[model samples]
Target: MIFEKFGKKRESAPPHQATPTDDSVSISRRNFLKKTGLFISGAVVGEHESEKFLKKIFKVPSAEVSPKEAVKIMPHKEKHVSAHSPEALSEPSPEVSTETSKESSPLDAYSFLDGQIHPVAIPTGELAGNTFSDLYAMYLGMPNGTVVPETLHVDFKENLATLWRKKFNLPARSHDERVEREQLQFLEEHHNLMNLAEYVYRSYDAKSPNTMTLEEYRNDVVGAVEKSRKVFVDTLPLVPTSASEDGVFSKDKISLISKMGESLTADTLMSLSFTELMPLDKGSANAQVFGFLLRNAGVDFIDRIPSVYDMLESFGPYQITPDALSPKSAGSWATQVLSALPLGFMPWNVDELLRGKENIAAYTLAMLNIAQFIGTRNSAQLKCLSEVMHTLPSTQRAKAVLSFVAAAHHRPHEAYDAFDAFIWSMYVERAHSFREEDILRHIPTKDLREYTGKALANYRFLASGASVNNST
Candidate 1:
């Protein structure tokens, strides 16, 4: 239904556009960089590089700086924001201004994979087919908090029996019962350790103002526990004529998944990084242990998957698998996972959904990914891509690159070939999609191209070759 609305709006809205002016067109790359807030290190290209590029392109006074010149520019410095809990977004406080009451907590700046290694630089060679287990230890060792004993409990059989016996109040019957009870008790101890692991993982939030108070966290955890219990009950097998028919926790996995889906709230999932919360590989990980309970909920709940992606991003970017050597191969993994994800579930567009920032860099990246995959690469096609990409702020270029690299891995050549190919397509699409008529009537601007061309130049400078293929 939501997609239906999107389709209708796409068809009904006036397409975006810019009109040709009698005045000379100013489409230099350098000037555009400064205008779009994508200006990086100009130590490589003087501040006036865009102006120079414009001059050369149109025989104007603009200076011409080569692409290599722009790449030398160091990226702008950023202030770091700290880890925040999900409930923290909505907490009522005197510290929050009345004006910003409606806003959710901003995304955390912590990187999931640690450090600022470029994806292009990583060698993804021997790691291609390594089972997730081979990489598990490394992930556990990550300092942003990967280890958890309660969540990582390895004795699933014992844990299951314990949970079953406790929930069902089964009586001790024989030597077998004695063994099961002992196993269950052992699992209980192990599961506690897993819980501690997650606590350590989430401990980083202690540094942020948005981190939940101990009281609030306790409440949220209790709520989450209750929700999980309800799901368990709903998924429990129906009782037969005899009450003694209490079998183990066995039923269709999908049924359990559906129950879990109903039990899950966006807030609960949003509270922790996806990886920490969903650590499917962890022995006692709730998401791994209980996630199967929600599989039947369908892709709508796919939003849960982003929980891990968010965790990964919070940890920064992981550059390599245990054995993979080619950065491209590793880079492509994110592309495949992200591309398969539906746009609705992405974290980039909460504002866009409310009809704000139609040209967010993250949103444009998704669109660009789709366009490049679906359309032939051409100048007209790239023009459309550029139209949108140029509109995004420079800070978002890395994000755009990250998502694109992820999608392109499946078809490496296509990804490499379509880099600029998609950009050009976007320019054309933006032109066709522009509602020139609407703008002319409702907007006071005489020429969209003036600002747009400048914006494009700046965006290119910001996004230009931070080395998508190799770690620069």
Candidate 2:
């Protein structure tokens, strides 16, 4: 989910939206980028360069549909690797699958591959294939993933240590030179993700006939992690760590909210990002590890990066949902404001979620606040959370809270409506099947329960590592 942003709603009411289509009225890329608020780096584009100078766009569908259509083309229709673990589902499209290493890969893994520079026999995934490892197989040029993302991350670090080691010369908003010395911790933790993204770009550029590259890859990745990390750390004292823990954001209580595309399943539109929180001990390296989760949770590599489609739906790795900023979502906004008070969020801090001013921090806090509300012990409005929370082990409740947050992220009030249906199912006739209208919300996902259930089980697998890397 990079804590991918898709959907959110206060009530079980759906946010009105036009269904996306591949062929229809089109908007210019410049206007679309402007509307998305991601047309950053004027310096990169400058005064005279053609729009082609902007690399953010990959392939503009020749037909030129709406910006929202971009979300539909890729993983939106893609299925999970397996129904079991993150990678364990049915076969994934080759680019997203995790493949075992060849033991000896062709020295010709890339167009850039040459004899003097041997294809380093790096650690590859146990399963079939994924972009991260594919990028890694190309990063120094090697091979990544467990649907159990840890398997991905574990070997990810080993496989692409070269990419992971890349760092920034300085932070985005570099302070005084002396102040920069004090911010060494930030330097060590936050800088590498964007740099790795840069290498991921070059890796593809080095490809035989590169099909795609998001020139704006750096801006999007930076928005997700770099800028987000800086703000998250500054407000570390104010955010809540977990719903279970008292509202204290500290080193000892690190509240993690992750959006892993890998956690997405068949029913859950592959277009949407899925979220889960896996706790890690807080130490000097805490934020850095959290950064890794934030990165992979949404779009881990070059190809998966949020496209122009993500421009309206969600932004950043945290998948910053629109409801937080949408004026019509006042009720949800109000609840967030009132709930966030005890945690000491200022008016601006709360506004940051929707404004896209501070990407990840706002996204993290927004997701956490929603998770906390959903995880609240006796919320009558959120019996879904309470009911699910009861069935889970104490350790798993946080993951469940986040799963619902993620499910709801893609479609407004989906989790709430699904829960209401689930709760009603307890009283509904247990016959083979009943009237679709009376029983289902016409969200069109008649199998919403199965989707949410798979989500819960998928996340459980993530925390448990039960299947050894979300693989078959």
lDDT of 2 by residue, 87-130 (tens): 22112112211121222211111111111221313233232233
Residue-level error in angstroms, candidate 1, position 417: 5.6
| Residue 457 error, candidate 2, Å | 4.7
Model 1 whole-model lDDT (C-alpha atoms): 0.26
- Candidate 2 stretches with Cα past 4 Å from truth are 1-304, 307-316, 321-403, 424-454, 466-472
Estimated TM-score for each candidate? 0.19, 0.33
TM-score of 2: 0.33
* Model 2, position 262: C-alpha lDDT score: 17
| RMSD per model, one decimal | 28.5, 19.5
lDDT of 2 at 67: 26
lDDT of 1 by residue, 207-276 (tens): 2223222223224434644443343334223311111222322343223223323322322222222222
| Model 1 per-residue lDDT at 202 | 25
